[model samples]
Target chain A: MSESPSQPAQRRTALDALHRTLGATMTDFAGWDMPLRYASEREEHQAVRTRAGLFDLSHMGEITVTGPQAGEVLDYALVGHLSALAVGRARYTMICAADGGIVDDLIVYRLGDQEFMVVANASNAQVVLDAVTGRAARFDAAVRDDRDAYALLAVQGPESPGILKSLTDADLDGLKYYAGLPGTVAGVPALIARTGYTGEDGFELFVAPADAERLWQALTGAGADKGLVPCGLSCRDTLRLEAGMPLYGHELTTALTPFDAGLGRVVKFDKPGDFVGREALTAAAEKAAATPPRKLVGLVAQGRRVPRAGYPVTDASGAVVGEVTSGAPSPTLGVPIAMAYVDAALAAPGSAGVAVDIRGAQEPHEVVALPFYKRER
Target chain B: MSINPEQLRYSKEHEWLSAPEAGVATVGITSHAADALGDVVFVQLPEVGATVSAGETCGELESTKSVSDLYSPVSGEVTEVNQDVVDDPSLVNSAPFEGGWLFKVRESAEGADLLTAAEYDAFIAG
Candidate 1:
């Protein structure tokens, strides 16, 4: 279906034709025409939790910062102390506006001592590029939009190691978590990083767009016996939600700070030089320690009814105390789980009297610790 | 996908109704609707003895990805709801016509606009 002439067209990934051949149901996500599911969302989700699931993550944004001061520029542009990160390692960080509001949660990979790659959300790619580019105006580094240059794919689950080991010569065993190494996988050049959003032991391969189809076929062929299935974005949402990872638009937004989302640990206050949002975030951090306004907490439904995003969370007296940010029927847990921003006083896990207003009905939900499911290491 | 049974009548809201026997009929969501709502996690049917007006929302079907309104195709009193489908909502996706039949209703009034199987097929195709 085409949009009106005034609306921009949705972008497709390198694997668009392949996804169609596999009978995937496509949906518009963040201006990208991406696969929502291949067969069943629950089955896809369970595959990632039990066996292995492969994902086409080419829709994610990749921005490159290079030069002598690349790391320094990141330190000032984003909240994390990226300059301290060792080569070949990645750090989960965020970029915030001057008002202490988060721009986007990112993963910064230090490819070399003088080069770094910042992975951003699909919807906020341009926003991140603009922010970082402006912040790097005085630094000796150059920022470039590399979104279209790479096709990213991930194989995640318990069997991921075995599945990937068969195709790559890279030291998958020695590649510690959050580490990436340049290598050839199935005769194609790739950056294999032992990082994923599925809360599993996995590898994310960043390869040239031209080689995506071949790489995908090789991975599919190699992973077939290991029980790997091609997954879609629908399952990816549930997987990340179960892992308690905050999505950029949902848990993080320009209206909320990393501190507000309970991600203040990503913001380093003791960095060598001044950084954006430092002053505001420093005060926000102090306020959070003393008396935070709202706190994010995990909510597990006590009933079979699913609690959905934007549903109001109420207290014992039926007063709105919070709002759900992300929620889904957890395939692994077999119950509805959610993440919500509740009033600070009632944010503690196991706090009494919490429920989600599902339509007109008040479905009971228990406040619990986050990460509804954690894979055993 | 299973074709809509010729003996059944369909509504534009994607509900299928079996021919009423003694003023009571079986109702379920069409396979087309079930396919659109992936991996149904929960189904809320109108309670037994509750009156549902035609073309009005009676309940909800919550899938993993979204929630959809379940509309009553005819004005009737819900006589029985399928607890089997409620207990295992995935049945809606697996067997929408048979095991996943949502509810039974004692028809009080007909909508006068139910489509035949062929008409329903053409409607969805369009």
Candidate 2:
């Protein structure tokens, strides 16, 4: 209960007013004033699991690529086969440097034959934009940084689609997974995408920044019948962690190659003949095909004390092994869950258990297959 | 949420102490203390019967975001432990004063410098 020492440099979102009204504890996240949690983290977490949760994600960056060579430009920049993505479809892609290290992972949405909208994590938006626009110059395409103009809201959970459908006439069922549609909700034009980080059926709504509050209120009003509650970044972490989704700085890094992240499938060497990082990716792929890098694995801590981030993992003989990347006492699992990178040889399920020195004491843990939990939706 | 004025007094550390019938006061953390700590996932309570000195670190309470330690408001032996909080630790956060209480202490001194309701609230506010 010490005072928050630092002030956030980033501007507050349209939800800041609402957050204040709801008595949210604000924290500086990626330069943005974001709510850490509304009330209890576990309570917020349980709501998302058993019901629906809405997220204020206006800080995320949306880059619009529209030109005759838009697809060609993206095909050159991203690891995923962007050229094959049809209009109104979205695919998860990683933008990488020429050295085969990932610059950023983004969702590339093919809005038209020549228009692609790339949604990147808030912190890395500028970097992704620079890389995309820089590459676009070589292919005669245009890139627009649309971060300020729009706000993104995620309505995530098992009940999300049902609640969202009640507000709009845009046949949400027709919009397949990883697809999007432009429609109006409560007389407000919005772009609804059937995509989210939560391991539940949901929609990510992108709307005008000025209209963010109104859109949020409207959805909450419409979604009241379906039990939608506004969630914060605290629960967002647990939800994504349960789904085994990687946070930018935690799992993925500019130095870590795609193959190291179990996302090598995103690199399409055969697509478009050659692209940025193609040679490097092929080299890395060949290098990986022979001897892969250390793999990331999930661990279930034996005790109630969670193995937090930066905690060292040790073998049976007290030999320092890997480090814990993400960990928490999973509200859903009712136990401590963690993810760590270990030697590929030792990453197999049930190979052996390890101990995490929680403070000065050794807390035992076992390697488990990732995602700690999942739903069919 | 009732401020039990006489049953137990409070500390800036958010600990509460019920005056012992004799010299052994029973100490536990308050409900506000638990909510401020967020979801109580793991609590490293001092061993039962472990000696604790006043204004000293007793044990740790780890939440999803950070780790905080409970302080011994009065020097004593950890005569009794709260197993309910240890098993379902969130009880500490949900009901910090009652079922969420951390531990009971057999005080070394007859009395501790406990804060009144107004004092603890003002300390928390500042």
Candidate 3:
């Protein structure tokens, strides 16, 4: 799947029955009974393209950090500088190990001067919590796992704003990308963030699971004329892959450093003091300037053949150069595209030719820049 | 969502085979299989001349996130393969019975022992 394996198949949310009714190809992803797709991937993909789509992202992890030094703790624990973030702003940051390996990439939301929320990928919920909890405890800051009480839903696509605005009394006009605010939907309290992974203008709503169904139904019923459709993981993968988004287990992992995954900007070395992995990050930066590990680059298959995950990457001489970490046939681009970590020399765009061992035969490919597709919608 | 066709014999793996009305048996994956796979992006069936036995792996069908083996329900020498389906695999999802058909074989009675649609459903339930 696009995310991590959920531990112990946690409780199902209000959308379980709806998914079954819609005939979703249900699977265990991050311990949630999520939909892969309703019926046709083409139709689902086009819905968000032409109109709006709703997603049940309740399986994601939400952790709250509140203390006098909460900002100071995350500033050191996460790779990005958090001290400059004003209230209601969210920054995508990575938590790195002492050796400069990524533990998880999460969205850090500054609620107030001393209170913050970090939403992590479901599979890495425990990993991020353990890392942050351990670090926050050093400063006596409380790290609470609010995942159990929270249900996350994404209202995505071009028509999302209009459909969702009618249901909420809160003003949704001023909210920009990566912006968040306390809002209400169907008279239930929730946190609305103007961010999504589908390369569309959408919002991520965090509300109680008890109210999830009502809000989802109200939005879906209200947005029906506006072309809003319920999306599953199937279309979700294609959408994010088209947007050049990095998945947890594939692009980012506990073993891979942020620098190796084309995330050098997220690592803040000039934060004025030593943070977690600070020395190693500085050292990795210096080492990378000399010899960067096989760099991550975009791949475009020559034919209709899709380059899959874990497929071996080879050079013109047929020698194994690296491996494809994540790939998919983009429904948006109508072409096969992928992302792989190849030797830094081969990582240069258009400079090298490679082949992916697709199924049994090798298919030719060209390295392109990240984000194989981007649309105004 | 529905049985592929009555005349065609079904396999537990969800393939359908019809004996050649004139010595040419046809083969295609069932509609259920195509739907379960979500979307049919890539199909790798044997060449038109490849010999295949009943219940043997003949080709592969890959979706956005999975790879499944395509098994033949009849034993015969492949006489024709649906190149049209290979070019546009979504046909398999939308038209698994006719346009999405994978390959055809010369008439072989050995392939006739495959399950019927009802029996195949029972096998999946079990």
Candidate 4:
């Protein structure tokens, strides 16, 4: 816990004390002292799949773009057609460098006719802030860094809605997926979004930092009898991996384009006017349509050995074909699963001859669809 | 079962070896190692008849988050591996000293580096 002379101190969330009190094993994540797990990561993962899991997502960055041309600015700044996004709705989008390299994948929430909020990964917050600010210079809009202004908490799982219903009077049933509304939850003003990274029916509540503890306690109390557990980043990683969602530093990176990661759908070519990376993304989209150099695919180990991140994937002849980006022993599947970017020819779901180099041994694996698990409606 | 530190020799690599009976000793990772490694998911043990050297890697224990090498505290011939542990790796976390005993080795030599429980405790405390 001692900081080295050259290293800066890790930031602590508003509920840092609460997490420690609950016996969370804290770890450094994206320069923040976040909980890696409260107890067993496997148990936490299973709870999220079966019951409900609460998450402290305050470390995620929130940048607000407001004013007359806010939508116009975002349309020119990100890959998505944000100008067309209706108020109260959210869109999964990405901001790429001029060369089409992914800067970061983002969730843009249109809060008003002329106001939008861009949520970026914690590690890429400042980068995204600078990118959006620079892109908004000529527009009649303002980009504000609201990272420290809010604390985000997520209640995710099948039982999430029932748990949240006890604390919030918001129209939980009418709140469509990817939509948000300003409301009061447990007497605290908040933005309740029906959005989540975990592939579950859940809600993410964004509230003032000062009100975070109260809201968390209220939700915990309400969810106590519903088998809700405070989960940590360890289970979060495995949960998202099982859902086939891409993580910023892992599945998405500056070296890869949206098309390269098989996320070409996030780029809206029909959006009016030129945006950042538009030309390059257009070419990338065309190239992807013809023959993608690498495509992201799911991998299930045929053995017990886990194929972890950065492990090399090989073909039958021992030629390296790809590398694992995110992996874990899926608590749901009871097997090791991973997502990897492999050569296009080997990306098909049932393609044979795929193996992961676990240490020096090439353990055989089967290529499958992107998501290893999906919630049953 | 409960660990009697006085009856066991510990390795700096976080393994615990019991006092030899007829030159055969039971080996498993210490609870501290198990807790640090998190939930153990998979294990690879040296096969029966395989010769392992003191302070050398004899197997691997893969946790959900990461993997660690299992080192033999004594140079010996592997007599048997606990198949129950091989079938259920979580025993390595739940019962590291009992049901999780990885293997029994007939020792030819014990490593001079092995520590008493007190010394091992002090070593890990640092």
Candidate 5:
């Protein structure tokens, strides 16, 4: 029988049934039917900071680059030196257009000498795949979009190690940050990576789509005492925001280059051969180093009034300077914080006269450095 | 949590107003609006002595999700604005009818369009 026409045609993750049974508040996110929150967003945000939180990140795109020239192709496609990356290590990089605009920020994991996996944002997965494929036309590497073949899960926070120790025989202790290795986790063949977006010591397990539900069950069962709660996109957003991570659609967009986002370091101008956007990025980076036009900074509001996205950021005389990209009432800081792009002259932390136009009132705010919160470890 | 006191008059905008005594009425958002707004974080109320018209936007209710306009339910001059709820906005979500009252208005004319509790419940239900 045909489905009702009014029903939303959203792609379901492998853990869809599990989320539904847990009473998750389901919502459509980037064409994927995902959970917005399993409980109170504040409670979930606190759980990831204090204890541990499990996340179903299956919607994120995973692309595999293989062949002898894989690293070379990555070097050509992204703004990082991927060829020199040691095996099993990962690098945070970005794909840019020819004009030096950011296409998407990505995490490229060097699995082996000739194999690398690129993890792209959910909304930009297809674009990344097409860009990488087009960039590899002159190289010997073969780019394959392997998104549907894997289910990604993350166990994040201070209690992550203890919670995962009971489920895997892999050397969880030896796994370093920004690294991943193929290993058995919870008796399932998986790529156990010590990487996460939460700015906490954590593991991201990449396994076959069919093994996802089993892995989730095992992790929850093993982590029952470690305060492992099923977290949704809401807390994940705030956690990454606290960490000052740039989300693709928010902090990093196609119109803005890495240099404009205070991430010029990710662009390796010294890398050999002509990479995409090298000349423009070189000029942009040089200009930014000399005198940046604008800079992204953190803002902390005094009152409870939240400075939401698209809110205008103003100067002392109430002159519009920039705009807020991402904001929320910080569950960790117990106040409202935001990331905004402001004029370079006033980008320094504690700069005077920064305020967010919340509705009609200009709420006073203090400019601060990025990453509002960080783990002690 | 969805209590609609029988004695209180409600507006289609989900505000409740106490029956006028000496032309003064206590006004607040109903439980239905509170539940819809989830957790209230901030509230901006009309200044005392400011004249207000029924069904007009006078203040705002900021929640975590988004900001919404608080419509004045009756035409009158504002008498008292609730400072207690303004100090702690969650009262709007907790005790929306009691400690969470927004402002009092001395009515020039009773809100003829205000609904009875039964009608208000039916309106929200629909």
Candidate 6:
């Protein structure tokens, strides 16, 4: 979530011109030219919690697996029980290496009986593509990298339904969470999914690249009175942090298994057939259940100083026990919250002897639950 | 770029120092610094009676994006700290020159030379 190091080149999304025209602070995110924020990040963060916010997520990679054995192939490729997923439903799962380390967490949306869309993070797009493709080589399925062919947009928040209802003829009221369907939005073909990372009611619209700008314009215009604003990666980070959603590089990483990140529920052990990382993850799960090394927990700083990623987490005596993964000054909670990997003994809420080393000063904090904020439904 | 106040002296670290009166001068970060840092979430000011040196980091400022050190423009003993800004850090961004003043410092015997508004402007432009 910090600044990217200088790279040789960067890629632009379909709405690059639109974002630049609106004076977005462009940053290099996983080699893609993406907006960090359009206006005040705090204001944008608050807007999403209160009203609505639009996001250009074209950089997120999409891979399609289609054929008779597509579901079986995904069951072998990912940690979730994809073969049992009903059509039009989405499952949050992770693609892991053979050793059970997380490669990437994904949202697998079953578009049809033989078709499923795997949305991966921008940094892990190619990794997921290669992993899924290689895993499906033996199955009667075809894995196609459709990232460059589609543009993704997300309108998230409380007022999302009303704003999106104005643009699309689809049954926004009936769209259940984690379900997706093909429909025309703003006169453009799209796959509208009732899923979001912000932990709010929202839709993730997938459209063709050429129609991205038009879709964005239509949403902004239709959402004028709904308090929808163009949000960027900055506010998105804080929002997800507040919601306790894990980002790939932060909460989930290659070095940590799904069990270590407290995401062992995504691993389906009862599924038939040997899947990649199944044996190793099973062992890791058993060991973790016995005596977990470290677990992810929420931390709220008692003082003003915000504990950032990679900062050392200290015990009562100021001994380094863990490290912070993601943190921000939450606009909704009016306090600084963070996710850290601490010893399992100290992972419970209100555990004592917890502090964050904020630039050599051991600022005390309280270990709270995963999410610091939850919207009233 | 925002205009640098003519009455206040400047520091290369993007801090503004008011002319010392009664051996005390006020301190605050410039608008440019606030703009670069985005909305300020936390401001750590030097405690009263603490001795600081010119061009040294005395405290820290944190934003949503990252953290930056608050540099002391002139060496002095910290006299007063702004409790308002310490409570509501956004004052540093909304009213940086007035209510956002971080602290007041009593000048040392060996006063430090600082930049004029034009010189600071030229320095930032370069």
lDDT of each: 0.93, 0.83, 0.84, 0.93, 0.90, 0.92
Runs of candidate 2 with Cα error greater than 4 angstroms are: A1-8, B1-13, B18-21, B30-32, B109-120
Cα lDDT of model 3 by residue, B1-126, tens digit: 436466778887788887577888888988778888878888988987888888889988878877789988888789988999889988899899989999988855555567876777776666
Q: Against the true structure, what is each candidate's TM-score?
A: 0.97, 0.92, 0.94, 0.97, 0.89, 0.94
Candidates 1 onward: DockQ, in order? 0.80, 0.69, 0.64, 0.79, 0.39, 0.79
Superior by TM-score: candidate 4 or candidate 5: 4
Question: Poorest 10 consecutive residues of model 3 chain A by lDDT?
Answer: A1-10
Model 5, runs deviating above 4 Å: A1-8, B1-38, B48-51, B77-84, B93-126
State residue A216's C-alpha deviation in candidate 5, in Å. Answer: 2.0
Q: Worst lDDT window (10 residues) for model 3 chain B?
A: B107-116
Residue pairs clashing in model 4 are none
Clashing pairs in 6: none
Best by DockQ: 1
Model 4 per-residue lDDT tens digits across residues A176-212: 9999999999999999999998888899999999999
Residue pairs that clash (backbone atoms under 3 angstroms), model 2 = none
Q: Positional deviation of A257 in candidate 1, in angstroms? A: 0.8
How many angstroms is residue A221 displaced in model 1 relative to the true structure, after the best TM-score fit?
1.0
What fraction of the correct interface contacts does each predicted structure contain?
A: 0.74, 0.74, 0.58, 0.74, 0.26, 0.79
Off by over 4 Å in 4: B1-4
DockQ (model 6, Cα): 0.79
lDDT of 3 by residue, A1-377 (tens): 24446544445767888788877777778777788787777678889877999899988899999998888889878888887898999999999999999888899999888889999998899889988988876785788998887888898888999998988987799887898999898787889899888888889999998898888889888898998888987888888888888999998887878877878889988885568998888888887778878888889988777788899888888778888988877777777889998887777788566888887677899988887877763
In what order do the candidates fall by DockQ, top score first?
1, 4, 6, 2, 3, 5
For model 5, how does the per-residue alpha-carbon lDDT over A1-377 read when each residue is reduced to its tens digit? Answer: 57689975889999999999998877788889998888666777788889999999999999999999999999999999999999989999999999999999999999999999999999999999999999999999899989999999999998999988898888888889999989988899999999999888899999999999999999999989888999988788889988998888889998888999899999998998889999899888888888877789999999878898899999999999999999987878978889999998888999999999988899999999988988897
Chain B TM-score for the candidates in order: 0.96, 0.86, 0.89, 0.96, 0.96, 0.94
lDDT of 1 by residue, B1-126 (tens): 439999999999999999899899999999899988889999989999999988889999989978899988889899999999999998999999999999999998766788999999999998
TM-score of chain B of 5: 0.96
Candidate 6 regions off by >4 Å?
A1-6, B6-9, B109-126
Q: Single out the weakest 10-residue window by summed lDDT for candidate 5 chain B.
A: B32-41
